[model samples]
Target: MSLSQSFIIGQYVHRNSIIHRLDPRAKLVIAFLFMLSVMLLNSWLSYVLSAVFVVCVVTISQIPPSYIVRGLKPVWLIVIVTSVFHIFLTQGGQLWLEAGVFSIYEEGVIKAGNIAIRIILLLVMASLLTLTTKLGDLAQAIEDLLKPAKRLGVPTQEFALMISWTIRFIPILLNETDNVMKAQRARGVRFNSGNIVRRLQSFIPIVVPILLLAFQKAESASLAVEARGYSPGMNRTQLRTLAFKKLDYQVLIISIFCFALLLALRK
Candidate 1:
């Protein structure tokens, strides 16, 4: 299987740390703010600061760096391609290498470095959120956070439930895909040996079974929810309540501080 096609799913690791104890909503909001700040940054210093911030947050979370990097393996190609294009195609400063129709400039090199750093920082920040927060907790947090949107005529609760279910099922789906691939392999199916078109054709058997199983699971889940008295437009009490603790406040303050610093540095 191609690197991009590999069954890599983000899994939450149980760690007793400040980051793990914070409200999932806080973590999600901080992650979004960090991503926005990183994207807004145009200088290399800002990118470096973002990278440091990511490392610090990951360290505080006590999640293994290996797991975060592993989750990012699928997107490494995209980062590389984007960096290469930025380095070679963008025009600025003195040329480092020049041919009849091609050149590499100093400014492009700096820009590419900044882009690469920002990409890595973004991935790390996202991975940190998934690593420390449970899918169920995240869903609840999202549901609570979106409560305000209900006044705007949006089905915030339903939307939150959808997001929660999707996040909750990602790992399950990945595991299911792995099992399906193994079953196909046992029947002499090779996913990697054929040409592009032939390989795609070979996927039909695998894809069909997965789709059927997904439908089966969906039906079962719907039935279970109905049996539990779940209904649209009805208020539901959650078993676990999300509350912002001292650590959450600390993290929020730090995140806001970092965001402001990043913005100021950008200017």
Candidate 2:
């Protein structure tokens, strides 16, 4: 697929690779730890190492480089906007650029770079998890993780199902939007070529259809779930239970070690 149309956030690719074979709960925990490590790390080298780790994990997942790059397209824009905000607003350190009514300082640049790096690292890690794991597995993983909360009267299974369904619907909604955009374009509606206000106005047709379709899809899914005897607060059994294997243990141990190493590097 083209970079502009790279896979959606919740789209999954099933492959026989090691990363794909990993237990969803294990992947979920490692993902959390990885993001935590990136945020806690202070040194430049530590950030670089974290970035390298992400690259390595992505490579192991066997997802196409183009797909991963495309997934990052939206994130790059946010990074640029936020980085610019930090560069201009943040102050201190040596002056980098001096201009009337606008000045750039060394600290501002560093801060902007720091924010950009953190955003990219987190997005990459999150995208990797979604791309590699199935939504059903993710739901199960979340429910398993939240099992302890069941004692507190929490509806863990329902909560997990809701979270998974929300994520699972993201790509479906995007697809619906694309179909609406295409239909609108066929009727001579210009979304990209118009001025700011015009462009915003052009989406009026697209938005209505998406909203309707979202409700329609949700209604249909609920009906199907109910037909299958699914009910909130009801205990359920899995066809294939998630069990920690040797490989899973090894991966978790390695993940913990990496986080510990990152923590040490921060000091």
Candidate 3:
């Protein structure tokens, strides 16, 4: 299944590989550091290095490259649009194309290339995070990390629960949408055989069912939580605690090294 279409609801492939076993906190921090480095990078050489790093991380995770690429396919259009805009609208150096009020420059092309690479790296990093970490683990890690915020009068536990539920429900919602589409197709609803407006109108039936299903699920979940003694202003213990392992320390060290290297290069 295409990563974009797959219900994000399944158990992530459990692996004892380096990427999978690292602490979620470490992974989150490294992701942020990697993104920061990518943003700081301006040269093609740096971008190439970043791409290699991403490839190494992806390989270690042992997930299919097709899944990663497929997830990125949905956003390809946006990337293209942004690239085109930057290539034509960004002003620098000598113009390559000049017509009336429109122009494209060599510098713009370079800028566009850099921007596109940065975006792709960002997507890869995000996909890596999702692929390697289970939704529950991510939630628990977030809650633990945000525990200090509780002293500042924030509902960290409740907020964390909401995030956990949202991530867990994404795949379920996608699956529900797929089922709705299949049923509509079986009922002779031709999704692709109409004008833009007609196609949109056809989606009404599909959307309504999905929304109703989501509402029902939400209601059930709420009741279930209440029955389980879930209270807003009470302290709760976690079943699966997250701990920083040796690999997490190694990852943090590597991130620090990369950040320092990037800063040195920038200098």
Cα-based TM-score, every candidate: 0.84, 0.93, 0.85
Q: So what's the TM-score on candidate 3?
A: 0.85
Candidate 3 regions exceeding 4 Å error are 1-11, 99-102, 193-205
Candidate 1 or 2, higher lDDT? 2
* Sort order, lDDT high to low: 2, 3, 1
lDDT of 2 by residue, 1-267 (tens): 332255457888777789999999999999999998888878899998898898899889998877777887867778999999999988999988988988899999988988888988898888899989999999999999998999999999999999999988888877777888888989999988868899889988787788999999999999999999988777899878999999999999999998999999985
Q: What are the root-mean-square deviations of the candidates from the true structure over C-alphas?
A: 3.2, 1.9, 2.8
Candidate 1 clash total?
Answer: 0
Report clash pairs, candidate 3. 8-171, 9-171
| Model 3 lDDT-worst window of ten | 2-11
* lDDT, model 3, position 236: 82
Clashes of each: 0, 0, 2
lDDT of 3 by residue, 1-267 (tens): 433264222336677788998998888788888998988888777777788888888898887787777667767877899999999889999879999998999999988998898888998887688778888788777788888998999998889789879877777777778888889989999887779899889888887899999999899999999998888989888787778777789889987797767656652
Candidate 2 colliding pairs, count: 0
TM-score of predicted structure 1: 0.84
Candidate 3 overall lDDT versus native:
0.81
